[model samples]
Target chain A: MTTGEPGACVLGVDSGGSGLRAALVVPRELRRPDPVRSPEPVRTGPRGIDAAHFMAQLLPMARGLLEKAGGGHITAVAVGAAGLATLGDDLRAELPSALAKALGVRRTALAADAVTAYAGALGDRPGAVVAAGTGMIAIGTDLTAWHRADGWGHLLGDCGGGAWIGRAGLEAAMRAHDGRRGGSRALLARAEAVFGPPAGLPGQLYPRTDRPAVLASFAPDVAACAADDPVADGILRAAARHIAEAAAAVCPSTETSADTSADTCEVAFTGGLFRLGEPLLAPLREEVAAQLPHARPVPAAGDPLDGALHIAAEIAAGRLRLPLDSRMLSVHGEGVTS
Target chain B: MTTGEPGACVLGVDSGGSGLRAALVVPRELRRPDPVRSPEPVRTGPRGIDAAHFMAQLLPMARGLLEKAGGGHITAVAVGAAGLATLGDDLRAELPSALAKALGVRRTALAADAVTAYAGALGDRPGAVVAAGTGMIAIGTDLTAWHRADGWGHLLGDCGGGAWIGRAGLEAAMRAHDGRRGGSRALLARAEAVFGPPAGLPGQLYPRTDRPAVLASFAPDVAACAADDPVADGILRAAARHIAEAAAAVCPSTETSADTSADTCEVAFTGGLFRLGEPLLAPLREEVAAQLPHARPVPAAGDPLDGALHIAAEIAAGRLRLPLDSRMLSVHGEGVTS
Candidate 1:
């Protein structure tokens, strides 16, 4: 896994829903550098991801990281970005050349954040990674091709994600306020305390551009109330089922025969949603076990930045093998063939 | 409700999700005028409804309607607007004065579209009206006060509404595409036919300002597939149950005591969603029958435009009996008192 010339460095960046972060790594030395972080996330526009805004935040951080690594020869750059599959056309079209010119790098990889998450969690191994943060997506690979499920953004999908859980909790709260069936008084009190009167929630929410994040902010409150509230617990259980379903959908089948019941697969859960603790995890664990009985659940070895670094190092070493999707993952410059 | 002076009229406008509609009513003769409609919906902004945008569309339409009515004296104007309950501050403060100054009106009544739909369906009678178009809401009164359930917009509640049903159908389609549980092949085929590749639906839908309407537009497709698809049937059934729940929540109690189920509230259905016909209404009928056995279901008497006209005529007649909530239903100028 460690392949680079002595005194050589590579850049890794993760531009995601929450923020932008970059790290510099000397792959030959096998030491992971601390990521330089920015609270600001890259902007999106009519064409999807704004390339100029991404570069504005990234170039400076990439430069600072390189300098902090003691002026090493920067050999490669890899970026894992949110919205990269559907919204990364502009980034893919421009970023490789942009980085090559600005940072004097010869190798670069542009990847969907999900792909990087897969790399981070399982490190090029054949497996599925369910990354649940402000949004949720499940990604998998059988070594030759990639598979994905449920990352269709907040409006169309992203079921079982943080926003989904928060929105479900809020719906139950509003239902209670209206005296409808399937309501919870605990969730209602929590919603009122967190977002004011239930009547005002629509006004507070519908107009916002950043609605997913705003919705996700309440997921913790939902988790907090899950222990005592059947409604809250139900919401989490439904979310857990969705998560496991997504995992099972993307997990590679291991049956050597068509009719075989036995199989083997690697499954891992990663990201901010796992931080909700046992109220969410206990049910998630049960659902995953029930739905993906043949798959083994494992811990994520690293974050997306680490995945970015892994891809960069692998590209530098001529050993990257996680498949090259035009939209999901692409290699550029001298590293295009390997 | 015929009390306007001879050669005098009242203006009625409905600014809703789909369009802007206005009518000039001759209450003295009890004649219903043909409505003038603009396809453009009023714009909303940070401060809620754009008063200037609303006035720009309304003033000219009002003046023209008045002129077409033989240059009649416009005594009052009643506007039934979407978002009026929550986003009508600018409209409430500025609309009355603007209409008064421009038209020399003495009376005005402004109401939420739900209220107008109620007025249109039952004509200020003691009953419940369920308005279901792109959004759904249940409103009821026992001749004393107003109660509402589930008009929380596309992102929140709007349970059993067109958007909700459409969203559920699309979710199933996506599940099918992803090879997840609860997937429906019929819905997948319908979704692919209507929206093209399932993978690109998020790009097609998420960026639009008219997301709810866009989602609602697919409701018929779901309905079309319901007869042959259990998934679609399940979605419709769930939606019907939600509709009944909302109706029951808002329906006024007629129980003489706490233990009696002998309620006599009349319930009526109105709006675009009902046009889905038996696929939706068939189950909705069963659900209403099961949930509100004592409540009677009645056919809608008129549309929201008719409701607006009725409100205007009632205001001119000085006989509007619907309770005057400051937000839900408001009376201005000379008609402030019954």
Candidate 2:
């Protein structure tokens, strides 16, 4: 609860619509002289909700991690949450205070989950990151300024994300039902088994259901059927184009850049949809190359939690300068002056 | 409330997401020997809601119509309603009884709004009709069977409807906000004027708002700006393609037809989007023609109420044999035998 030893340990948390993940590690060890000597993080359960119920799950998880770590002084805690975008200005302003009250720590930081993904992908470097999971968004930073594309939720955007892919699959299935499109026999049978008869799809989707999650559940089926199913392949190709376009929107084109260092836009990919591997990445790489010739895909250095930990370390070292609004960053229940 | 006198008059109603339109006409006059002698319908207020609240508005409207029509004997009442597709089979089964109870009529017919549009456009002929208003759907028939495409609501489908156009415009506006896309200055200003700023749009749309209506409201702006705004033009082009694709999906291809009569597919377009006239129709016709070379656009003979009246007249004369299941048809709360 108190401000523990200065250079001791830090807690990093990543919370999303599905659940929460947290890790505890030594701040100094994260930047260890020898990469092999870096201490392994203590991982825990997935236990969180949207921003509304964030504290309810987060407080206990933080306390549990502190208790389990035993003896070490917890220096700071950094959290990246899925629902941060919905909080708006007032809630964002109060976030540090809320975290301070719950974790009982004087040093804390908060950011959107996308930020953590970006940090995990590129560290403090200037590059673009496309995160496509239940939702999709692209974030690019030239160190001095940041740009965002899409991630406008399932209704308006998230064109190439899991939900988008699933929606495409469902539409194709419906088309197949009407004999409008082929390659839906397997998809239709699978959908019927998972939900109900094709006639009941509208009832299952609209008004009452947790639409994003339900639609996202269909993404895997689309991927599975992509090999033999022309419809699924078409969806994947379209998704790749959308994702690439989103990335291109955020990442600077090589032709426009004056600085040679910033000329090559190193892009990174993350989230559940990427786990589909070659089916998605093969076309996605082609799309990125076609759309942004200078952009190159790089493997992510760590996950969002690791990014959270990295941010926590930077905050402790007084080296963190967020390319965000002052109001977007809070420390110990107060705004941080950049 | 009595079954009145048979073959006296018939009431036909069309209900949509925004409002309802009804007409009262004599069935015998609908089949007048001289086409010029057909009596014009008695029109009333546009009074209806989505399927959930349909009866609340519909019952009163029906009562008011009967009261206004006074001495005329109501032979039959036929209704075509929006959101009918979302209703499960059980609810559809119970609709006739509910309608009968409300109107105090034994002979009643019910169908989805698209069916009425199709009937109005094609007039019992074997052809396709695409209705693109607040929502979009294509209905096609080969005399023996029916085919439907899209109309999956604003969330999943309604691909080329007013809502779809509006959504595309809104997305373009948001993309402009993020500097991801161009040609949205006028669109953004217009949106801000109507919806009170771009940042607040997500809050206004998701969870709480009447999303379809709100999105559809933007279509007019998109149509208005299409000539000058690249973003608006892009939206219109995409909408045209989607609409054509949907129509093509339902309409039988020229190559597959063994019957020479079916080779030339006559297509009729209806709904508010078509009211945009040439901006929509020109591109839509081109796309439809390109995709469906055999299909030609036709001017609708009458509106959905006329179609409903046509069905009512057929029912009064005992000449109506629906291509639907017998259980779907009821006469005075009793199932009809084909």
Candidate 3:
């Protein structure tokens, strides 16, 4: 119900580490314009993702994009937030009414960034996608159900993720400093250069609110030292194995899916972690090949923002095939049926 | 310095989890009374252990104990602080002057609890002692120098400590919850019983300042499940291996020590972690035996407070033989010539 071309379109919003992005897309269109983006990441609190903070950032970006595109009826809206699974309650509860009131949007899909990564990677297909950055998560669908692995945060899981590798590398550095076994001289040198002396790392790290991000910052250092350091190399290899384990854990097995019609599914990798190149990816590829023989690795088609756009368009077209998961992926409002 | 029956005694203070304790100890005496105790763990801050909070707890307690002991010359003071190795700067810089001003103390030994445990276990003799509680550390002496391993706090190290076992057990529980490989149903049951649900464990942890202690609290649950759960058993065994590794790393090797006269040395295990009993200690013993064959395992002679007393006694008698280490153990008084 806008002033533009009376054509059906949907709004997509993604909130993640870098910032917030909102895009409008026409369903079934071959080409789409660049999304309006804001560099401010939404804040999270005890209540979860701050719904008010999110709207404060989103409304302007959405309106700006909509006005520029001369938008028509925004049939549905979907938002993908980084911590939607564990910390999205505030957003999930408040976003629908807020969106409908602000933009006359009735249909809303609140999806975890990993779920959006999955949709964007495989397009409602029965497959798995791993989005690994400071933290890592794998989401796979069997069409009827979704399987998830890791994303348990740096302490519990997120194994083989950026934080994990950095922690391992730093541990090796500390070991070297302590003259203990498993110490890596090269890694130790890198650690000293990056974080100052190994002795101060715990004090510098443990007290921080952004510990995961801080730990992940060192992952690249670990990767950089792999060529000359066995300890660093071993850390990367172990990370690869762990990542593969998560992938294998979540990928739909041929013998164990509601729809066993497909024996294999395409697996995709996304996120900043993969940018470390072959030091991490090469072993990751080997591990994935060894662990999930039935799955093939593929390049990710888009990012979480694009995934949000895709989900919104699917909802608008009444062709959203992804099963609704209460926490992982959910649809709100009675105005939409798919 | 005290109005007692012409005897030499020292004030030994232990600042740890349970609380603060001060004892007027007559070194080399076979019999000793219980230490005056205050149920207050000293606070830590950006500058490290709050020197003010520490003296507030120690001053009255030390005075009362000295008065109770019928007034004797407080020959020396040795404070074994739990975080002395890393967070002891304020305590080191401030405690000497504070103790001198308050208690007429001159000699002071500021030691990490691990060093205190080592002294309590092996005295000033050459050997290694593993102190594993919520965290773990191994300290050894070759007469001329001290060797430290692990004790890098839970994030970087403290492998095989209570926190490590608990974290591993919880990881298994999460694995079971996610239906992933390496799942432990027994651990899952225990985790849910203790932490409510495997899903909520991350939120329950990660945010707290006392994360290590909270993680370690689950160690007993893990220990209880070890008898029936291979996963739990494996976690403990791995912890044992890590502990052994640390011990091995720090224990003086016949081939590497400056003083190679001793063919073998005594090794002792200390702390609440050892109280987990055979479920953990049995494997730990096996791992230690395998790794530190040259060092014979021995029961600790006393607790850390006793160790503090011992260090104070040594300092007072001018017989302190533990090599000075800037962080591990530091002597901070000109009157001390040991």
Candidate 4:
């Protein structure tokens, strides 16, 4: 079952509101230096939900990945899901159990989607990390502990998350429709181009099932418009400020020594939002840096899937611990087949 | 009908989104320094709309006032409305001519609710004022010039307006209902208290006919909660700041003299909101004063209706002029009356 290897193997999956990602690994090495079996990325969803629904999508995704991998060597599975807070502990526990039932395997663990993303970016390090995915959330650790601020979904806050960008883009489009905005031909054209034949735009956005992806698709156009458009720039600046606030909120509440460079922490980027490169990230980085001058933006080594696998390995090796360090993650995925 | 006297008489009516108030006025020199006419306060339901409805209410009220006056002559009629804005010439042209028609008179004039209040307070002097009535708005003006900001209505801005207070209070109630905030008993009790033996509290609030009044009733409770309730204080403070912003927007633009009293151009308070006295007004007045030292707050001259009448006299005298000074609002009202 173990591929005749002495070390243990466990799988980790980060099921987000937008997509599901899977990572498989050997407990002794968590680093994903190779692309083979290290942390294979697979995009699946109809999004995640409160714990019960999270487990539902997750278990099937895990089983499919396990089936494809020839199953025998897996010791445990860990799932990271979005909306875990809303579900509270009751549903979280039930979800882990539900996953085991669905996969016909008894071993499983669960944590916040944010925690996993933090693990991916910081490798269990204490510094804070925000997952600006379809929804934005900030999670951090002061080495001894962790805290979160403003991840209350789209209706409440999310801030610099993908959904916000998408919503902003859509609003810009609507403003164009109503002739309130000065000009947005580029945005209009992009929307028209997306809803080919043009007539279906309303149905696609208002009623169609693919609204999230459809909206997410608009983020790029918004980024493109940001430099040339004042309105777009305003929106991006606001988003960046919001995310920076989130990061600041989660950071340790204390004053440190004068050597800020050493005292400052990394503000890692993970999720589709970071892909916009500097157009979006630069402002966000600037905002966070303005507040926490010592903090620097570090690109995620890979993504949350990698961190999930790294964490899974830690658990298998009996080295599972909180305040995971970046060094542990750096080496954890090296031996896994990418 | 002149009663063989050089003294003038003016009728001032204050109309809001929901009600109408008419005041019979005898200018300061003609009677006791206080200008209010006893009894017959001039009221009408939901008659804040057209000339016809207004006439229906006004004729009776006017007749009663005249009858009470032992057949004194009427010199001029001045009217001020809450919802009406001084929308420059273009928007003003679009306003229904029915307003003049409703008063059932050859002379009719209109002015901003804020201006009316300003005139009532400063009597054609140059200064600024922050009015938080059913909704919040701030307007300031030098005698011949004016500036305004943030009266974008309930959904857009309103800020410290009564409606804003009510909405914040409602939100607090909802938070308490959902267990997000504890001990909102005062808000709930106040809400229930206002609805009266209202076929029950919920019944009165939900009944289509009573919803507007029921909702309006919450604004006072919001202020009441501010003294001790954190949630209530948060709402009031935010609103106060919003109102302050509105006042600040006009401060630089206002006209004033170097030797004028320090509080001259500083923001002043009027409207029902100030009736809550210092608790609410102090913070609002301070915030605005902090921003614009000259942003003074003066007590209103009884009501905007007085200002309206004052303006009506000036208009009848052919003193109608452009860029009317808000201080001489009575003069402004008179100038526009014809």
Candidates arranged by lDDT, highest first? 1, 3, 2, 4
lDDT of 2 by residue, A89-206 (tens): 4335554667666655556777778888888788877788898888899988776666788888887778889999998888777766655534377677777777787767876787
Q: C-alpha displacement of B32 in model 3, angstroms?
A: 2.2
Q: Who wins the DockQ comparison?
A: 1
Candidate 2 lDDT, B1-338, residue by residue in tens: 11225537676777654366767674334331211111222222222223335555565665666566564655676776665555424335554667666655556677677777877777767778988888888988766566788787776677879988888888877777666644288788878888886767776787555777878989989888888887788788888988887888878555654345665888888877888777777788789878888787899887777777666655655566445532223333444553
Identify the leading candidate in terms of lDDT. Answer: 1
Off by over 4 Å in 2: A1-7, A27-56, A88-91, A98-104, A181-196, A252-263, A327-338, B1-7, B18-21, B27-60, B85-106, B181-193, B252-264, B326-335
**Predicted candidate 4 versus true structure: per-residue lDDT over A1-338, tens digit per residue:** 12124544577776654466665664344354332221323322223245555454555555565565455456666566554443334444354455445544334545677777887888855576878866777777665555666554442345567767766666555445433323265665666676653223543454344444566777777888888877667677877887787777666533542223345676776777778767787787678778767566677765777777666656555455555322112112223221
For candidate 2, give the lDDT: 0.69
Where is the poorest 10-residue window by lDDT in model 4 chain B? Answer: B326-335
Deviation (Å) of A215 in candidate 3: 1.7
Candidate 3 is scored at a TM of 0.94
TM per prediction: 0.94, 0.82, 0.94, 0.49
Writing each residue's lDDT as its tens digit, candidate 1 over B1-338 gives 45457767887889976679998876455667788987588998877888889889888888888777767778888899998878899988888888788888888899999999999999977878999988899999876788999999887899999999999999999999999899899999989999999988998998788888888888999999999999999999999999999999988888522224335888999998999989998999999999988789999999988898889888877888888898899988873752
Q: What does candidate 3's lDDT look like per residue over B1-338, in tens digits?
A: 12123567787788887788877875345666788888678888988899999899888887777677776667689988887878888998898988888877778999888888888888877888899998889888887788888888887899899999888888888888877778899998988998897778888997788888888999999999999989999999999988888888888876656566778877889988989989988998898888887888888988888888888877766677888888878887866543
Error of 3 at A124 (Å): 1.0
The clash number for model 4 is 44
Q: Candidate 3's error at B109, in angstroms?
A: 1.9
